[model samples]
Target: MAMESTPNIVGVDLFCGAGGLTHGLVRGGINVKAGVDLDPSCRYPFEENNEAVFLERDVNDLSPEALAPYLEQGDFSLLAGCAPCQPFSSYSQSGRSKKRGMDWQLVSNFGRLVQGLQPDLVTMENVSQLAGHKVFEDFLGYLKGYTVRWSVVECIKVGIPQSRRRLVLLASKLGAQGLELEYDPAVPARTVRDEIENLPPIAAGEQHSQDPLHIACSLSEMNLKRIKASKPGGTWRDWDPELVAPCHRKESGSTYPSVYGRMEWDVPAPTITTQCFGYGNGRFGHPVQDRAISLREAAMLQTFPQSYKFAPDDETIRFNRLGRLIGNAVPVRLGEVIGKTLVNHVRMTQGEIAVPSPAHHGRLF
Candidate 1:
C-alpha cells in the first residue's frame, strides 16, 4: 500500500459529470489529473472539490494527441468514460428498435480514443442494459488487446444507498491480471434513513436556511394531500379510491404504481432519477416527511459526501440542473471500487504482490 512502490496511475475522466468518478478514484488511490465534460457548470465542482483541471469541451472535439500530455506524465494512465446512458435505458426500450443511431456511437468514440491513446488502463460505467447492444459489443472488441473484466454490479452491494445497478468494466494491458471486484460479504447495505433522515428538517416546499441544497420542491394542493396519506413503501393504491388520480383509473396507468410512492426507510431507495426531487416523480417521497426528497437528499443517495459542494454559496439552488448532475453521476463509492480493482491488478501484475492461484483467481467475464 506504500505509494512509492506502486506504479503511478494518472486518470483523465471523460464525460465526467460533476467529477463523481474522479473524486472516488482519488480516494481509491488513483491520481486524477483532469476531467473533461461539455457542461460548463461542471467546472466549479470538478475543479473546486477534486482540485483537478476541468475541460469544458466535448469529448468528440478532443483527439488523442490532445490527451497525450496527461498520458505522458505517469508510468500508467487510466481513461474512464461513462457515456450518457439514456439511449440504452429501460425507459427508452419499450417498442423502440435497439439499433440506436447516435448515442451508442459515443461508446464507439470512447473506444476510438482508447485505441489511439492506448492508456495502460481503462474503465467504463453505464446502465446494465447496455451490455446487450451492438455498440457495447463493438466497444469490447476494441479492447481485445487488454485484459478486460466487466460485471453488472448492484450499487447497494457496494455500499451505495440506492437500489441502482451499473455496468462496470476494468481493463489493463497487463496479462492475466483478472481484475475482479470483491464485494465485502459482511458489510451491511446502507438505507435511506442511514444516509438522509438525520439532515435538518425542512417543511414541504421550504429550504433549510443554512443549507441551500437541502430545499424541497413545492407540492400541489392535491399532491400535498396525496403525500400526507402515502405510507412508507406504499403506493397510491393505499389512498381512498376518490383520491386516486384519474389517469390511474385507466388500465394503462394501473401498472405504474411506483409513482408518488414513499421510499421505505429501511430499504435502499429506488434509483435516484433526473426528476427525483418532485413529489410525484417515482418513489422519491421522504419516508416520514411530507415532501419529495430534496436536492441534497438526492445527491446523498447517490453517495456524494455531505460537504460536497455542487454550487457556489451565492448561487440559487436550481432543482433540475442539480438533479440532472446528481442523477447522471457515477456513484462515488462504485468508482472507488473500480479504482481499487485497477490498483490491485497493477500491483499483482508488477510482482509487488503475489497473484492469486488459478483456483482463487476471480474473473468477471
Candidate 2:
C-alpha cells in the first residue's frame, strides 16, 4: 500500500478585520495567500503579523475573477468570510428594522463568491444570533453540492478567555463525511486571569509607558466614582443610591443590569464589544483596577497576541477606532481551531492519516 500526497491548504480571508482570523489560520499551519477588507487600517496589522498581502476592498464588490488567482496557487483552496456581525448581533436586535443597512447583505455576497468560485473549502464565523436570521438560511441555500456543518460555539470551550458565542460553519466539496470543528472536553476553559492578570496595571486615562495598546480610556469624575464602587461580578445594583445613574433610576433602565459592572478575575470576561473601552459599557470594568479594560487587554481577551500591533507607529491610538477593531475581530483561538480542522480533514480524505472515530471528538451540528 502506498500513501497519498496531501494537498497544501491555502486560504483567502474576506472581511478580515485586523487579521485576527488570518493570524490564527497561520498558527494552525495554513498558507494564507491574502486577506481582503474595506478598512484601510487593517492593512498594517494584517500584513505586519500574518506575512500575507492585504487587499483594501469591500467584500461586496469582490468578484470571483479577482480572487481566483490567489486560490490557483495552492492545491486545496479555502475561502473564509467572517463578515461584520453587527447586523445579526443581539446588541442591534432592538433597532434591527432601522439599522438593517449594507452589512446585512455582506453574508449573502460571501455566498455569491462561494457559489461562483466553487472553492475546495469554505468557512464563516459570526455572532450566534446570525443562525436565527433568514440570511443564514439563504446563505445555506447557495451551497447546493457541498456538505456543511455549523453550530453556535462557546468561546471558552475553545480556550478563548471570553464569554462569547459565535456561529461557525464549514463546507467541503471533497467527500461525504464533510468536516466539523473538534472540541475536547478535557481542555480547561481559560479565564481572564490566565490571559491578562500579569500585565502591569494602568489607571484610568493613563497609557502604559512600555506598550501603546495597553492604554486605558479616560474616565469622568462621576464615572470614576461609579467604577470604584463596582465589585467584581456585581452590577450597578451594588452602587449607592447617590451613585446610581439617572437612567438606571428609570423603570426602563432597571432591566439592563449588566452595565456598570466589573469582571470577575477567575472567570472568562463578558463578550468584548465595540464599546469595550468604556467602563459604563457592559461589564468591561477591570476587576481590581479603577478603570475599564485597556485596548490591549480587550484585544488579549479577544485572543489576539499581546504583541499584535493594531496601528502604524505614526498613527494615534484612538479609543473608538481601536476598540471597534479589537472587538469586531473573531477570537484568534477559534480561527486556529477552524484551520486545524480543515488541515486534518484534508489529510484524512487524502489517505495520509486515519480519520478518528466520531466518539473521539465533540461535534458541532
lDDT of 1 by residue, 295-333 (tens): 999989988898888999899888877877787788899
Clashes of each: 0, 0
Top candidate (TM-score): 2
Output the lDDT of residue 329, model 2.
Answer: 87
lDDT minimum window of 10 residues, candidate 1: 90-99
Clashing pairs in 1: none
lDDT of each: 0.84, 0.86
